[model samples]
Target chain A: MSPDRPTLTATPHNVGVDAAVAAARRVVTALLHAGDGSAAAMAEVASRLTAVAEHLEEHAPTRDERLVDMWAGEGVTRHDPVTGPENAVAPPLPLSGLPDGSIQGTVTLGLPYQGPPGCVHGGVSALLLDHTLGVANHWAGDSGMTGTLTLRYHRPTPLFEELTVRARQVSVEGRKIRTTGEILAGDAVCVSAEGLFVNKHLPRPR
Target chain B: MSPDRPTLTATPHNVGVDAAVAAARRVVTALLHAGDGSAAAMAEVASRLTAVAEHLEEHAPTRDERLVDMWAGEGVTRHDPVTGPENAVAPPLPLSGLPDGSIQGTVTLGLPYQGPPGCVHGGVSALLLDHTLGVANHWAGDSGMTGTLTLRYHRPTPLFEELTVRARQVSVEGRKIRTTGEILAGDAVCVSAEGLFVNKHLPRPR
Candidate 1:
């Protein structure tokens, strides 16, 4: 249970340009984990990066593009961060639907996804489970936006080890869809998530 | 309510190298969001970045340096991706403990933190709340790793907007500590999280 309160701040200040930018972002993420500790060398690299940033800011779009705004980045089409086939950010889950309507996928997180020493970052586990639950909703024919996500870490999800994920639609009531999923490293279950998604009839950007 | 399944995974893979690498990651995250779609120009930048990565991997640390594994790298000392003063991965919550043993902080997430089109990533919200709840436990003299985190999203936490967060220790049940917190965008409550932390007596790397 949570406190019923109001805490409205402000709307988004800037909108992202297009989906292509996220692709570039995935690349940047790969490079960041791969840097040396030379101050002079890094300074030189920073200057170049700054120049690129300034140019984009100068010419960046003012209006938001309705392109997919997901970690998977127009998933199943081009490269993406979460589920892309060629990108380093992906756990690269190749999913197949079971006969029971539940979805199952396999992935292996590497050093790039670490947060707690050798274990996978807790958020990364949430991210993967969220996406998996969303996929469950999509299979249910109610592809909707995530209204809420709840997660419990039974144990640390490991990296560099092949893991299996399974998600199923628990229920679909009106616009609200509920789904549950669990992550497993072999037979051992590590993380579980429950997500609520709302399918909007009104026009909303993807 | 969860399966009392006894399926635990293997231990973590490895600890991160050093604090300096996180600083460099912050740079990479920024540069990725800044690219303006010049493939030729980015390719050139990529080449230089590749060289830097190769050099660092060759000279990376072989032993633990006791550096913080958090975005607060070398914490309160150097810049990092999650809790740094000048990093995009951080919400930069400036927190203080209240009279009743609660902690409060204010944060405004800009670009590089978006999950949905205009809303803050649910995982990001969880990340901020998880850290805040842990900070509250620290104030109460019982800091521990997250065992379970349950969150409910009442409304979308917007990006690029100022939000207020508060956390308080609720109860201590043996080794388990339960805490609750909420995030508000002004007055509208966007997200709420309940965390369970258990301070282990065994030696664990930072």
Candidate 2:
């Protein structure tokens, strides 16, 4: 059974949704990177964004209905927090499947994802790896819920620089699947992760 | 030496920035929840948000300047991805220090952080635990970079619900600080984590 769930997939939309999400992310990044400490200006921007929210609310479907639509068509692909084009919080990593049964992508994070000084947050790296590993599983024709994840931070992942992320399945035994993944700043591996995922429909022994 | 870094701290701003971030996050949430597949409406919303971004850019300071200001005071306290008020990506967890050298917080996540059908992304849980463990270190008067993190997802952490997060220092050996944390939905622990952090001023073993 594919542990494919509805909420993780992208919803049906034209190219316009992608563009809008991209625009929203740009707004988020700019807000994080800029701010001259002007209270009046801040209020003004807030009011403008609030108006946008109100307009969207007036024209959109409820989130629950949207979730069902995503799963009905694409299964577990797209719209994920790590790679969903519709999610503004996502850097919305663009990944490709490899001939060797691996998956990899590149993303340039900015101030919005920063944690240590100019580096990416340790957990964000984990988020990327987790999703990448899931994609790797999908590439290998298997899927499961993340059961355990282990990560080692070799160095700080810098912000505003292109970073490579890759993941591949290591082994699968019945309901359990193991995968390994890493994030790289150029040639330097900044963080590496291993995850164990359990098939969602299987019964567990107590 | 406090493993305090400037990027993780919140910048000096009046209540206006806080309100602005909150509004911006609401916009993000609404965008994710609504959107009825109307391309023209989406375009209109995108244009409005783009204008807001441009207005802020015209009036705000650069990100580097903001980073410098965050570290010059308070030192590794706010503006963190897990608890920063200025960061729209943060659930902006409300955390409190405990007398027993622990830190605890509560946050109700919405669609922006979802992964599994109705559950929080496993990686998101890791993100919360990682930040909470760092808070535990801070409450214990110590701080360091995350060296290794391990997580076990006992159950799916649900979205749109108040979740309790808690962390405490388990041990400190020289430059190594070990902390444990967990995310609880009501009384059930959904995810638990252990992390090893290294002090910034100390030399790591080869």
Candidate 3:
């Protein structure tokens, strides 16, 4: 079977909800594309996208179990071209007993990220680092927005390789969470970053 | 004379050198357009552009005088269409013998910066903040590389406004200079930023 083929678990019926969520996502994506791309319009688009993503998560099969099974499945042994192949094979985070100050994930850079001949863009590198660091801050029990980020490029990160990003909390003072991370290409450190994430009261969902 | 017209500035004895530099810039621009845009390539292009800029400064008769002059002559008023007309007509730095903590300059934002319909791109805002913060750091007697930068967008910054950016030194610890700035559209603060700049010893050209 192709990797794209969905394997329904032995659970009770949820196909109607899943299909509805998928259809909603398609409609939202289309609406966002049709918008004039203004700030107000994009803000609305982002809101709609967030709502669709949340609904999809609620209606879909157990994400962790499905991801683990997919990892072991032959159809998903390799990376997927879209939604990211490396990301598709990524091991799901076990929510049972989460750690205090560590986060780990793997991502594959694709053709959409060509900055140099075959290397990733610096800005893209910054984006990934910021995201992983933010996750780490959240995991460390200090959920916050990125207040500051400092990146040092040791060398060019080659595309198509499975990059491992790990972040850990250094300390937390007042509302700021200090964290550091490194992107490793195999055993070599391709980029290093230090960031200060500031905790802010999240707006209540309307 | 049209503001875009390139006038003879005291008639440099070697006009051939200026022509050669212009030709080189054209060739470089063409080569950049042909290559896979990478961070390394962008850095290389930035370096080459800096070289051309420095060459022009060296050959221009009133370049040094204009550097200190608050109101520069019309020679430096032409807008570069590539980077956008926002960069055109950069005002000269007015370095009066006051204290060591003064930040001042005026820049125009134009249509080329339309990332979100009528607003500037987020990255472009960061770039402008970085550049302004770099100058502020230099003025504060701590010329250094950006160690960390944090920006908070309170509201979307509109394009084609005479935005005023003001930076002030919050504190200094050892070699790190901490400063904060805000981009004001009219009386409202559109974006606020804080940055940590580090001073590293480097060989200066004679």
Worst ten in a row by lDDT for model 1 chain A? A5-14
Candidate 1 ranges with C-alpha deviation above 4 Å: A1-41, A55-59, A63-81, A84-100, A110-112, B1-40, B63-81, B84-96
Candidate achieving the largest lDDT: 2
**Predicted complexes: DockQ each:** 0.18, 0.45, 0.03
Report the CA-based lDDT of candidate 3 relative to the real structure. 0.44
What is the iRMS for every candidate structure?
Answer: 6.7, 4.5, 21.2
Question: Which is the leading candidate under DockQ?
Answer: 2
Per-residue lDDT of model 1, residues B92-169, tens digit only: 466667767887777776544555556666666777787678767877778777888888878888876889988889
Per-residue alpha-carbon lDDT of candidate 1 for residues A54-90, written as tens digits (9 for 90 to 100): 5544443332431232222433322233454322234
TM-score between model 1 and native: 0.71
Cα-based TM-score, every candidate = 0.71, 0.89, 0.37
* CAPRI-style class, candidate 1: incorrect
* Candidate 2: C-alpha lDDT: 0.77
Report the lDDT tens digits of candidate 3 across residue range A99-169.
43466556666432323334544434554565556556655678565556676656668766888777777
Interface RMSD of 1: 6.7
